[model samples]
Target: MDAQQVFALLCIGFVLAAFDKKKEHFPLPLLLLAAGILCSFVPFFSNIEVTRDLIFDWFLPALLFVAAYQFPYRDLKKDAGLISTLATIGLLLTFILLGISLYILLSPFLEVSLVACLLIAAMLTPTDPVSVVTILKQTGPQEAADIVEGESLLNDGTSIVLFTLMSTMYFESQQFSINSFLIDFLLVTFSGAAIGLIIAFLANKWMHLIKDNEYHIFLSLLLAYISFYIAESLQVSGILATVAAGLFLSRHFHVNGDKEVKERLDGFWGIIELLMICLVFLLIGIAGGQQPYISYLYYILAGFLLMIAARYIVLALIMYLIPFWRHRFHFQDYLILGWGGMKGTISLALLLGLNAGGKNSEVIFTLTFGIVFLSIFIQSLTMYPITRKLKAQEQKKKESS
Candidate 1:
């Protein structure tokens, strides 16, 4: 489809979704996924192709920046311990457990290697911030939501590091060295963070000099692209840099001078987000349709089981280590946390970026997409119910006291 047609369809979808009060029943992503699938059935629409350059260069940076800019820095700081644990140690545990579980499950049927399994696990490790934060704003507790957002932000960087390392190992047939891995991971993360900090500091210092609202808004948008580009050029994590810049700008730049400008910027970005959401889900559905469903039926089922088992095991381990978590967050809270870690566009993008000639590339991509689809549809839809129940239980306890 041409850009105009794509934008038109996206606008229609956004309007329908925005006006519909029953958003809980048919979330935006699910709706977009359905629309994409339905559209693909048409002859003309079937030819629509989503390019990696569009996603990596245009959409991702914008999405990351918006998420980062809107995120409350002070609230994130307050729950630093919980967020840190979940994003870092929690992510590592999830990757290891999930990787092992998938390896064991797929070992008998397919000659799935450990490295390939790890790559898949790493790809799905980071939860999509856009979906989670949007949902959390409505259903989760204030403190819990902040922690969730913070964890999501940091986990994206961590997951990319793990995914990049595992992808290299799989394609290059390289042996794993702890020292080398740690050094690479640390360097990527630190460099991304540093770039973000520098951009934020400079933006803050100069933002006061700009009096025009339109110009200020433009600067914010430009800053997002600059951060991502600079980070990528430096061989650091562009995702991390975009996020850091967003957070920095949000905290430092005030929208007080012109309400109209602020509103216009918000509206413009809101449109961008909706279009991106539709494009992403559309790509996901198209990718899903390309796979032979019957061939991977058993593998998909096994993957589902493995993911759940891994999540529970990891949660149990984390809870055991930090007894305070058990007291602070109940069983339902843990369950929601595990389930809410739904994989989305980032995972799909990474899968597509994998070398097609690499061994097990097709199988890995198909299974990854299937696993991610199930995670988003089943887990994301049910997360709010679980969280609501947990919140009710907490409220009851407080009332009794």
Candidate 2:
């Protein structure tokens, strides 16, 4: 879609949000998606197009930055270990297991490369915890919200790294080496984070010099965009850079900036976030409706099922192996973590970047789209019920004691 069309859709998004004031009918994102789907039937929206650049260049950095920024520093510090483990080791496990299972499942029915399967798995690896975390925050069990948000923020970097590596392997005919992969991963991840840290450090110093605290928002906006641009230009993880910059700047502002300015900055970013989320989800529905994958119905269902199963298996494995995690996060928490992992715009952006997988490229795209659609549609809808159930269980236990 062109800029005008995008802006039009965004206007519709705002209208939809206003209509869903109580959220009694549906979550805001899902409601927007439904609206977009209905709009997709119109002849004007028939050829709705979304490029990787359209999303990554326009939407991703700001959304990532705001999510990271709004996340509480204290919560992040407390759950740092668990979040890191899930983002790294847990992500890798899910990728491997899902990739292998997908290869076996699809091999009999379709001609898809191993790297392509891995790429699909990689696309699904990073969770979008926004919807679920919002529900958890409104309900009880704040720790689950913290861990889910923190893990999602970090895993986007690692998932992008994996996606890039797999794309290279498939497109360039390069072989995977454990040593090289590890080295490259470390370099991209750390370098991106380092760039963010450096930029944030300078920005924090600059923030101090500014007499008008109101202007801090401008600096933050520049920091979010510039850090991501520089990191991507340097062939590092732009997602990580934005996340790091967002986290650092947010902590700095909260700890030292004027209360009024902090609130102003938050209000500013909140608007940006709302607009982005609305447009993105609406676009997701429009994009999904553009393609008729009726023939891939079984494959889509199987792929989504496998993805959820893989996530649960990985989380269960982690809890089983780590006594600390087992004690700290109970069964219900893990269930929430597993189901709450929703895939969204990032996955679609990565899917759009697929250019070299021949016919399998289209197949992978459809599968990723289907899985993401279901993940957001189903997982997001059920999040409140899950949290409510857990809250009741906790209350009942308290009353018994």
Candidate 3:
């Protein structure tokens, strides 16, 4: 297919997703993923694959920029401690334990190395901000949603940095040491933020100088791609850079601009966010279409259990040990937190990005796909009910008090 054809289909995908969003029964991500899966079998489009470059280079920056801009920084600041703990410590523990436990549990049967297990863990660790924002709006307390979303926003950078670290260790045959890991983690995190801040600062200045609202809106589009590229070029976490730059630029742009610029910026990014979501889910479905699900049933089931159990254990420990968390968050809210760590497009992108080491690669990749599908489909189905129960309990407590 020519470049033009691909763009045309993406346009169509956006329209389809827009229409589907109105239907309460089918959430937009699931709907598009399903559509992509069904479309995979069709004779016309089966040959064309959505390249990893297309997704990474284009789709992701747009998604990340808009999400950061829309995020309530004030709310995030208040819950910084909990979010930081979950995003850093909580994520690291789950990623390590998930890999180690899976390696132990599936030991003799699955011929995967410890390093490979760690890589798998890192890939699945980051909660999807895209999914976080979309689902949390309908359920739970504002604080709970803020913590989860903030953790997701920050933790994605952590997870990706960890993923790169693990990948390097495995590929380069380097020994993993705590001191080395700590130094590298700090380097990646700080570098990403610095890069973002600098770019966003300059971008803001450029926008203020421009009097045209249209140019300011379009400049945001460039800001996303530029920040991501510059960060990646410097060998740091592009995702984090994009997040930081977005938070700053959005605030700066809104403060300096007239009403028209703010509205235009919001509208343009809004369309891009929707389109990115649609295309990502669709690509997930298409990528997953060729897998032998029946043959890989055991891996899928086991992987799902391992991921869920790891999350449950982390939540339990965090709530039990932290007095503030224990007192502030209801047990039901804790349950929601455990189940709410849904994986999406980023997981798949990482899996595809890594060097495949023969047959075992397929197993790990398929296991990841299973986690993502279950996260979006099975877990999402129960979310509304869980939130309803939590809200009801919250209301009752208010009445009783």
Candidate 4:
């Protein structure tokens, strides 16, 4: 399908999402995904593919920017230690535990290598950003929302870097060394943050210099892609760079700009955000058709199970380690966080970067895609109920007090 045709489909998907959003029972993303899968069967959309280059260069940075920009920096700052622990330390622990389990359980059944297992774990490590405002909590607990959203934002970068590290080891046969990995990890993360901060600072300054709001929007766009490209070129985490830039720019970006300019920029980004969400999930659904789902059923099931177990274990440890975790968080809070850790576009995008020569590429793709489907359908679908349950618990405790 051509660009125009793809745009048409995306528009339709957005309409569907809007309608689905009205229905409390229907999960918007899950509906979009289902619609895309059904559309994939149509003869008109058979050739449509979500290319990796397109994802990295354009859509990814934009999505990452908007997410970071929209996220409340104040809340993130308040939960900085908690968020940082979950995003970095907790993420690695999840990857390690999940990877080891997948290796032990699936190695005998599936011929995938240890590196492939590590890659899978990395893909599952970060909570998908698709689930920003849990539909279940119209006015959810701010603390829980803060931790969940902050972790999702920061962990995307960590997950991207870890995925890259493991992919290099698998594809290039790079010798795996913990010391070297630690250096690479630290360098990549810090460099990405530094690049993002520098770009955001410079770009925001230039934006203010411009008299036109149109130019301001244009510069914001430039900042996103430029940060990503520069950081990637330097062998750092471009994902983090884009996110950092977004967070920095939006944190300082005030609503008190020239009315027309503010409106125009908001309108532009609003459209971009809607279009990205629609197309990304639709593309996910479309991609699923090409896979051999039945063959990897076992892998999909096992991976999903292991992922849930891994998230639970890591969150529990983190909660235990932190002195005040119980002071603010309860069992339902942890449950929501664990289950809300849905996998989405980024996970699928990283699979495309996997070595084609790697063992069972088709199987990897299928399992990853299947797991994503489960995450959206199962986890996201249940988030609302969990939120309500937690809210009720909070009310009971307050009344008793």
Best by lDDT: 2
Candidate number with greatest TM-score: 2
Q: Mind giving the per-residue lDDT tens digits that candidate 3 earns over 38-102?
A: 87787766776766666778788888889888876676667779888998999999998898987
Candidate 4 whole-model C-alpha lDDT, 0 to 1 = 0.79
The residue ranges of model 1 lying beyond 4 angstroms of the native Cα positions read: 253-265, 392-401
TM-score of each: 0.91, 0.95, 0.92, 0.92
lDDT of 2 by residue, 32-151 (tens): 877877878877777787678878888888888898888888888888888999999999999999999999899899889888899899998888755544444554467877787889
What clash pairs does model 4 have?
136-384
The predicted structure with the larger TM-score, 1 or 4, is 4
- Residue-level lDDT of model 4, residues 1-401, one tens digit each, is 59876777877776896676453456667788888888889888888867777667767888888778767667777788888999999999999999899899888988888888888888878886655543423335556766777788788767877887888887787988889878878888889989999999999778778897778888888888999999999989898899899888667754333457656767887778878777777877887755777888878888899999999999999997777986677777787777777788778788766766776676677778888778778776666667777778888999999
Model 2 alpha-carbon drift over 4 Å, by segment:
22-25, 129-140
How far off is residue 360 in model 3, in Å? Answer: 1.4
Against the correct fold, how does model 4 do in TM-score?
0.92
In model 4, which regions exceed 4 Å deviation? 21-24, 133-139, 254-264, 397-401
The pairs that clash in candidate 3 are none
